[model samples]
Target: MKRFFQSIISSNSVALRTRGLLLLSLLLITTTFNASATCVRKDFSDSGGDLYGTSLRLGNINLTSDDLQPVGTVLATSVVNLFPSVGLTNPDTVMFECDLADANNIYQAFATNGDSNVGGFTNFGDNYFQTFFRYTALKLTNVESGVEFTRIWQKVPITHYATVGNKIQIRGRDFSPIRAELIKTDKYDPTPATNSFGCPGPSAIGYTGNYTCPQPNGYVAFSGPGVELEELGHDANLDWTSWGLVRYYALGMNLGPVSTLTNNNTCGVVSTTPLVTFAKISPAELTAGGNRTGSFNVQIKCQDGVESGVQHGQTSIAIQTSMPAYVAAQKINLVNGSGGVSYLLSDGYGTDSSVATGVGIRLEDSKGVTRYFTGWAPCDSTCASSDNSGWYPVLSNADSVGESGGYTTYESTYTAILEAIPGQTPKAGKVDATAYVLVKVQ
Candidate 1:
């Protein structure tokens, strides 16, 4: 069973920096003065004295008495929030609990109740389903900049566990009072003499204080007994005995057990692939003096229609060609020992112009509405046309690529009609081209 865990891990490794330009527009100053006496100029280089003039010609230009002030407001500053406001997309609140996977086999690997399936006690490590206490990967994006910052959390601890008779069980419960280490923040001081809650600052990022934040900065350090949750492979699945539900603030330095990224049993299914082999395409005989036509089918299957549990559960598939056109030889490369043959792809089923459409690719939904794969207009109910290319949906269960859907898998076949341009001499070598397909779920 390939879990979506790795799929997200691969996607999360990518850094999402939301570039924002907070321009502070300044107020322009314009002043006018009235004159009552004849103007006289004074050069400070020669003498320093008062000039008897309504408007004084101070070498470069004229300046009225109103234009000069002995003292003026020198500087003004205002507080600006550098980091954009970020939090859970679904819930507006700051606290929420994450549920671990319900699969029995996964829990049994670490459950210590001595169940027959119990392999032994093991702490959830990186790549483990329960890593970060199975918290839903929170998507924190800056709406204005359109860049998603880091997923809200990198790690968490198993807050509670219990035993049912001879079998051990892991229950999903509220792991409240949990806080992340504050790396960089513009809120209060990095080293506060006394926190807004009247609590003193801790020595390190994960230390605990007596009082809760009067106003949360959206993150806190993991300052609690959960530090033991980061131990290496667990020796025993002890019940939640001494660890009472006493809510306190503490920062855990080391994540117990969940050390090192493990790559075990994390492969997913190849949902999309070429349906047919283009092994030995018939050579385009230039001497024969006619264009050649052929077709291949690409299988686009959404094995899992939508992501489950997560707030944003939509999935989409995007497609793009590696090269604009196919070539062979020094220009046109060969495939294995096969002779070179230049080709172009088109969406039409019958006779068509490969040049006019520019390797056209089309996608037909379940309703059979065909959309050009080259690009799409950006809009909701009404789409406004533009020249933007790429990042558009080729296949999706949702209306847009970013939307969410329920648990469902969709499948479709897109036909790629290959054409060998006429009147061009074909090079005698293998012919190959590349296309990239990506699947994204939100």
Candidate 2:
């Protein structure tokens, strides 16, 4: 019976081994087929059209629809108080005790504290929160353990949102019962009546000293901190006389940190009068000359625009005349025996010439050679024997001529004079001259 049992066992073992091999072959074949189906092909599209399959991996492994979870929620409750919350309001500074570990864990804090999820969790750890209820990155020191940590945070100050009588949210954290004290600012009166320049004229004026506005006249009182009177004036047309509330703010204070609230004590008021300006030009006097010509420079000045009470505008100068037929003339004459015997003359005077006068007379011989003479001469003349007859007599007197009938005269044999004074000569053109004159008379 033992031998038969062993033989049966050995046969069963062989059969089992054969069956296992078949099963392994079938599994391999099935796996190969599945892998081929999953492999990317030239024409194959991914399950969701995500060519890179990133969305597929994320959806399948990390964010499966079946495993979806709701976003975390957090509740923060705190309160802070600000002092000197009146006048030129400043931000309030308040200290908050937060768990260092929790603050450093940006992901946990944002998820649990209802804080904003900004880029880079590291930045959240570095910056903290402020009394202005705004998130800010800050360097935090764990005093309990002497370890330093950074976190993005926000604070709630008593003065924050006090004007509207609403509580400020700190990094989405809620606060209640915040206490704010009214701050006393140095009183500033910008009233022109109180200023050295006195009340503003019909013009714009600058602030010189600590200006104050009278309480009853064209002025309103400020009640809360962070109110901007100057900005209010700008919006209200610089008329501070109206009895309504105006927005007021300080120049260099940070609006976020509660610590800046220390500067709230400074305050100022402005008059309601609107700035005005008036200007005029001096009347001009006209002058007349021989040609009905005259000119005057206009002077312009403002009556009230300048701080010194004198604002001047640009002055324009121009000239005007009515005479178009005005002209000028010069005279000269010709002479002979000084050189050649013949010359042609052309006076600078044009057709408008009422009278002709010589400028320069040229004497040319029959050969066309030329000589020039200037100045006037009397009539042709003859010289007496006592006058040394060998010397030719100047043409000033006809009796001084050496021999009057020796030379023949022709109509073309006249004197030649320049019609105009040649100012400059061109390289290949006629010379240009000034034919007109300008005169100034008082």
Candidate 3:
């Protein structure tokens, strides 16, 4: 009888305990868990490419003899087709974008001067400005271009979307039309581990996957951020030969949806090179009596059958030729001249009441387009308005180097003349001046 009574009590206790647990489980199911004084937002379904050790190629840029001597030389660059859609390709939808942050998550801002390393390198070398590091700036936007980007990750705390298109190409008082020299040096090296993010030591690997940006001479860069992410497009290997000590910038990716969104763009980015030759005769003495002519040419020769592309650093692409300098004098930086100051008279020369003896220059090509220039200002900013220069859309004819209407390399010579200012008296002062010719290809 006592044993029976004890069993009944045990059964009652087990039943009661089970009922209590069920009630508590129901209550817990409705309540949301939160960390101490913080909120963590996460997407459980986001499966994307690894941000660590990812290198998307941005086509190699072969440095000219002039490219190696500069402190802040551009390692390489290519046309970044960011947000290239006619109908629904605006910024409303979530698209793939290149992350500008380094390991520390720093990026560029705006500037009046050409300097745009505003985020400043921290962490790995937080705010540490070394030799090459000091001049090694990564700029994209400028006051002239009127577009800028602030600190960013794919999941931005705020909406820092650009109004038109975000660009890493540097511009300031200049760069009205020139889109070259867009360096993306977004700093974010906030770490103690040199392996993850820091300047490379001699003979040591600079990046995680063995792309050493050697110190003192070399610096690292990221892919263009504003490029439009796509699921399918042209695919070509980047075929550029890296020159000098400047190591190639490894194209990286972001975590989560950003990487997921850029699934195809990461593989489709190519570094293509077009043949641009300039028989530049700058510092040529201008005579009031005659015109000294110089020649500039941009020839694109391709493999007979292979189309042009950049992903593999190939120098094969169909390009249109134009005098990009005349169109973009404010932003054109020659290998051996001061930018935005071309043809502007040097100091010590008085011109209060002088005739419009402004340096005279003329540009002409086989397409029968001619444009003239006289001095700086009132024209430098508005010079391209009257640009009727011939821009040839030369297709790839390299395979037929000597054939009918096709040469392995189709070369065109454009004449650039430096003469006295038209209808103006020749000044009696010195005639030492440079007429810089900037050849642009599309």
Candidate 4:
């Protein structure tokens, strides 16, 4: 009886273990089915009535984002080493490609001076400033009978005011932006008008619907006064290089793609180099108990590409002398010579000047406004009483400056006078001093 009971118990245990394993396998299968149900691949679905998969499309341009920027968008440093002057061509060329898939699409090309007037680097008016754009080649490769065309423009006058950097805030003193139409033309007229906006208008030679102009004997009407035939139209012909140029000014511009092909119309925000250099410094010969006058100029080249926010008003220039003639307790020490001589330098030269004599130095702007230097001063309220002097600011707190083409220069004239104090005799040697001028943009 014990042997029979042991055999039945072992068989029952084995049967229970087998049942548990089967349940676990069913649970795993159910879980997997539930998970797969949540995410179905519709790409291969039969719900469309067709067992075959749907068509897939993946289109991409040949150029990268960075490469497209220079061709289309404007940046803060959007400087193009283009046109040296009116009627001249840009030294650099910008190249871009178009997909045949994008054929028949209209595109716009533009450039703005970023100012009110259509000014170039030389500040010439928009009437003279021109921008030339053309394609080296145009090929529609997808088609078996691929269409090939080229419309080359030597120069297209830019009329619109545009900027690549921060927008200009000043009124009237703004730049106009120019826009040229990139029209996919029919071979009927390969070359477009100067400002062509695509054809089949009320003025086009072939007045028909849907850009289809039926010209007699394939004669394409040219734009302008008087009727002129420019080209012969052909069937299934594609012209990608036809463009029209127009100009206008604006206080600001919306930064985005100007055409389907380009990302943005602002790029090449190149800075022309903001610089200040000592143009001319006059040497001085002083006489004992007499005054010596000299002048120096600091040239500032604020190029056309300077940010609109960086106007002349925001520029600061400071002038300081090397304390060529130092005096302590009525004893003057010459910078290049020995012995204490009583001497002083002043921005004031004439008797009517407000800058006190014996003051360190007076700096002036182009407007004749003056400020006292603290380099070596004790003469005026603007001057420092102590020997620890500071640089004199040429522009006043209330002053605002303007910019011009090429370069703007600031001149500071000073007088070095030797005044003999009590028990101090004038020295007979060369009186020399060094001055430094600094410019800052706020």
lDDT of 1 by residue, 204-241 (tens): 33322211211111111122211222212322122312
Once fitted onto the true fold, the runs of candidate 1 whose alpha carbons sit more than 4 angstroms away are 1-270, 278-315, 323-406, 421-426
Clashes of each: 29, 71, 38, 36
RMSD of each: 31.2, 44.7, 19.3, 30.4
lDDT of each: 0.22, 0.19, 0.26, 0.23
Displacement of residue 417 (Cα, Å) in model 4 is 4.9
**What TM-score does candidate 3 reach?**
0.28
Q: Which stretches of candidate 2 lie over 4 Å from their true place?
A: 1-361, 377-442
Please report the candidate that would top TM-score against the real structure.
3
Report the lDDT tens digits of candidate 4 across residue range 104-192.
22122222221111111111121121111111011111011122111211112122222223321111111111111111111222333
Q: How would you encode candidate 2's per-residue C-alpha lDDT over 330-357 as one tens digit per residue?
A: 1211223321112122322333243222
Q: Candidate 3 local accuracy as lDDT?
A: 0.26
Model 3, span 1-442: residue lDDT tens: 0001124334587898987898898777535322121211111111111222112222222222221123333332222212111211232343223233411222222111101111222211321221112222333222224342212211111124222243212211111211223221333332221122223221121221222331111112111222111211211111111112111211121111111100011111112223222232223333425555655554433223322332222232221212222233333221112112222231222333332233434555555455333212111111121121221123322222343222244444555555554444445444332433222211
Better of 1 and 2 by lDDT: 1
